[model samples]
Target: MTTRARATVTVSWPEANTRRLARQHLAAPAPSASASASPAEAVGAMLGAHAQVLSAAELSVGLRGDGLTRTDVRAALWAEGTGESGRTTLVKTFGPRGTVHLLPVADLSLWTGALSAVPTGPNLFSKDARMTPDQVEAVVAAVGDALQGVELTVDELSDEVVARTGPWAGDLVMPAFQTMWPRWRQVLHLAGHRGALAYAPNRGRKATYTNPGCTPMPGPAALAALVERYLYAYGPATPAHFARWLAAPKRWAAEQFASSAASGAIEEVEFADEGSAWVVAGDTDFPDEPARGVRLLPYFDAFTIASHPRERLFPGTAYERALGGGQAGNYPVLLVDGTVAGVWHQRRSGRRIAVTVEPLKPLPAPRLRDLEEQVERVAAIMEGTAELTVGTVTVGPHA
Candidate 1:
C-alpha cells in the first residue's frame, strides 16, 4: 500500500490572532445588522457562549450582533411574544467544564450526546456518599417526568425526586461551591447535559427547570461532531487544550483527535507557541493585517475562554491582571489590539452607568478613544448613559 503524508502549515502569532478575532467577530464592528440578525445565529458562530453569568452571556451576544440589545437576547431565551414574533431559539444548560452555557436550541442533541460520553470515572460520588447506578438512573427519570409541561425550582424538583425515588436520594449530600449539594441534585446537572432538562425563565428571583424537548444524538457520533466544531472555532489547538476545555479525560480527548486526523477531518499546523496544533482541514486563510481596536469583554466571554496559548492572549502583566490565580472568567477584560490589556467593572445608577478600567500599562490616545466608544456601546445596550474612568480598581476573586 502507498503511504500519504499529512500536510502541515505554519502560522505566526499575529496572523493567528487576526484569524481568531475575525472568526470570533471581534476584528471590527459587524458591517451590517443582517450579519448577526438573531441570537441563535450569533451564538452558533462561536459554537456556544459562556453563560455562568446571564448578563455577561447576553452582552457577549449583543456585542457580536449589529444593533442587538439585551431585550433581544431575553426574548430568544424565553420566547417572549406571540407566534413567530418572539422565538425561543436558545436554551441554558450545563455545558463544557460542567459550567452553565447558552447553547442554540437546535444543537442540544449534539451538545448533550457529546458531553454525556465523557467518562467521569468509577467513583463519581464521594466515598461517604451512597448512590448506585440504578438509583442515579431513577433520579434522572424522575427529574424528566417531574419537569414535563411544568417548570420547578431545584428544591421543588428535589422534593419530587425524593417522592418518586426514595429518601436515600435526598440523603446523599456532597460539598460543592462552599455548600453541601444533594447527590440527587447532581443528576439534574447531568440531565441538562443529556438534553433531558433545561432552564426556564425564573419565577420572581428563583431559577426553574423544564424539559428541553430534544432527542440526544448517540454518544460516539456526537463526540466526533463536537470535535469538528471545536476545531472550527478554537483551533489550531492541541489535544490538551480541547481536553481541558471539555473537562474530559486526556486519553479520550487524544483518541478523538487522532480519529479526526486519520480521517482528514482536521490537519496538523505549526503554531507559534504550542509548536504543533490542529485546525479544521483546508482552513488556512487569515487576514493580511492584524485586528486593531478596543473591546470591553464581559466575564466569561467566549473569546476569553476559548483561545489557547494563554501567554499570547495575556501577555506580560496582563496575565495577572486579567486572569489572577490561574482562573478564567473571574473579571471583565479590556482587549487592546486583540490582547488582554486590563480589567474593568461597571456600576449602574438609574439611567447612567459608570465604567472603571484598571489598565496594566498606560494606553495611547487612539486606544483610549476606542475604549470610550466601547463604553458608549455598553451603555446603549443597557439603554442608559455611560461615564468612563481610567484608573486602578479591585475586581474578581482575590479582591
Candidate 2:
C-alpha cells in the first residue's frame, strides 16, 4: 500500500529557522540561518518560481491574503534579504491612482489584492454630509470636463471646479473632489494600464495631477487582468482586504474574486485561523518558513496585512500601539526571521537614522544580537554611513 510522506514538522528551533525553510522550499539562498550560500541564488529562486520580477503595485494586490498595506508588502520583501543593493523599497502607485507606495521589489507581487471604481453612490458620497452624491457627481463631471484636454494642480483644479460647478456650492466643492477625484484617477490609471490613456503630469509634488494621455478604455478585460495580477501576487486573502486596500466596495471586490475563481484562475487556502484565503497559484508561492533577514519594515508593510490572521504571525498583544489607525494606517516594523518582532521608528539626529525598536516582548539575547546585526546591515545599505543605537530609547509602558 502506498503511504504519504509526512511533511517535516519543526516544533522548535531558533525563530530564524524560517529563513532556512524559505531557502529550501522557495529556493532562496540558505543564509547564516543554515549553510552559507549566495544571496543571488535566493533572489533567482524566488523570481524563477514566480516567472517574473514583481513590482510593488503587483505584489500588494497579488498577495491579497489580508491586513496588508503598500508599505507592509514591501517590508516583507526586504525581510526576504534577496534584492539588489540599496533596493530597500520599490516606488509605485497605491489606491489613489498615483499615491506612491514604496514596496520591496523582490516580494512586490506578494500582496496583489483587487481594484475597482465605486460609483458616486450614497455609500461613498453620503447625503448626510453637506455634499450629496449628485453634487459630488456634478463636481466629478465638471472636473472631468475641465481637464478634458488639460492638466491642473490642486489649486488650479479647485479653481476649475469652482468655475464649472459655481462658488456657491461651498463644502460640496472641496469634499466632492476629495471623494471623487481619486475615483477619476483610478479610472484613468486603469485605462493607462490597458493602453487606453497615457498618464501625464497634472502638476508637481504639491501641484500634481493626471491628464488624459490615451484613448484606450480600461474595460473589463483590462481590469480583469489587473485584478488577476493582484490575486496572483497576494493571494489566499479576503474580499474585504482587497476592498480596503483598493478603496472599492466589498461587492466589487467579491465580483473580482468570483470572476477570477470562475475561470479556475484563483485558488483558495485555509489558514489555521483565518478560514479561507483566495490566491492565484500561477502567481503565488510561499516559503516553508519565513523570509530571512532582520528587516525594519516601514509603516504598514504588505507582509503585515496579507491576511486578517496576521495575529498568527505577530500577535496583537506583542505591541501596545496600532501604528495603522485607519484605512491608510501605517506602522513601521522590525522583521526578524520572517516574523514581526516589534515596531520601530527612526529619530533624526543631524544626518543619522537612529532607529529605536520596541519589541512586543523582551527580546532574547540571540534575537537581540540578530536585530543589531540586521540594523547595522541596513545602515550600511542606507545613507552609506550612519550610527545604529540599539535599545537606547524606550516608549510606552510594557504591559
Candidate 3:
C-alpha cells in the first residue's frame, strides 16, 4: 500500500479501555524495549498535556450512540465529567484563541502563564485594537453589573454591553473588543488563566453560564508548568501545533520547543507517511500494530485534530470527505488494517445491530470478514449478542 494509505488507524475499543490506555502511555517515563506498565496510565500520560482532551472526543464516538451535533459532542464531554475530578479538565482556555479544551490538573499553571504573557499579534486582541485597556475594564465592570452575580452566555454578555453603553455601544463596540468575545477567549486560555464565569447544567444536558465573574489567571511559574505539560504530552511536535493550540506566537512556541528539547521532555520522529509529531518522553511505543477494527471516532477527537502536517494520520484523498470543505466533517468511518477505509453506521431491529459499510475503495474478502467479526464483537458488548449484519449499518429506535 502507498504510504498515504497507511497513515492513520481507526479502531473500535471500549471508551473506558481507550482512556486507560491513554493514561498508561502518558505516565511512563520513557519508551523502553520491554517496559511493563499498564496501557491505562500510558494513555493518560499521552493525553495529560491536553489534559486528556483528545481522549474524551474519542470516547464520544464510541459510546454516545451516534447522530451527535457539535453541541452534542460538548455535552458528552461534560457528562463524562468535563474537567471533573477523575477526568481530564477542559480548562476554559489553554490552546490558541481561548477555545475551551481539556487540560491535566498537573500542567495547568505552566501553559496558562505562557499563553497570557504572549502578545496578541495582528489578531484583534492585539494592543492597538478598537478596545483599549480602559474600555475592556469598563466592559468587564458592566458585565459584572449585568450578571448581578448571575451567570450568562456570550450572547447575554454582549447584550448587556449594548444595554449599558447604549445602542451604539453595540454598534460602536471596537472590532477587537467585539472579536474578543470569541477570539480573545483564546488569549485568556493561557495555562494559569481562569475565567470568572460560573457554569450550570442546561436543559440540553450541557454546561451554561449562570454567573460572569472571572477567575484569577495563574501566576508566572504556574503558567510555565502548564507549558511544560504540553511539551510532555504532545512534544516532538513543531512550534506550529503549539502556536495553534495556545494561540501563542510561533516564536514563543519555538522557544518553548527549544527549552523542552533541552529538558528531554519531548522527542521528534518523522514517520513513513504521517511526518513528525511530538510524542511524550516515553511514548515511543505508540501502537504500531493495526488497530483491530473500525473505530467510530467522535467529531473533534484530539487524535484527529492533534497537529499540523497531519500526513501521519490522514491521506490527501480522505480529507475531501473526512473534512469536507474545511468544516470538520463528522462521518462514521471504518478502520481497516490500521487505516481509514470508508464510512459506516449501525441499524437496530429488535435485538440485532445492522452495520452499513460504505467503503471508499474495495476491500479483500479476508479484510471484510475481519470487519464483520469486529462488528459482532461490538454488538456482543452492546446487546449481549454477537449476531450482527455488517453489509449496511444504520441506527433505528430501540425495539
Among these predictions, the greatest lDDT belongs to: 1
lDDT of 1 at 189: 72
Best prediction by TM-score: 1
Question: What's the count of clashing pairs in each model shown?
Answer: 0, 56, 73
Clashes of 1: 0
Cα lDDT tens digits for candidate 2, 234-326: 444577766665556789778877787777776666534445556564533444444554555444344444433345456565333534333
Which candidate model has the greater TM-score, 1 or 3? 1
Give per-model TM-scores: 0.94, 0.59, 0.57
Rank all candidate structures by their TM-score, best first, as comma-separated numbers.
1, 2, 3
TM-score of 1: 0.94
Candidate 2 clash figure, as a count: 56
All candidates' lDDT scores?
0.82, 0.44, 0.44
Candidate 1, residues 1-399: lDDT per residue as tens digits? 966464468887788887887777777665375555478877877778888778788888888877887888888888776256535899999888878889998998998999888877556666668577898789888888989889999889989989999888887487788888776876767888777788999999999999877788999889888888887777888888899788778888999999988888888889887887888889888668987888898888887787888888999888887786766777889988888999999887898888999878898998888888999998877678999999977655423
* Ten residues in sequence with the least summed lDDT for candidate 1: 28-37
Error of 2 at 356 (Å): 1.0
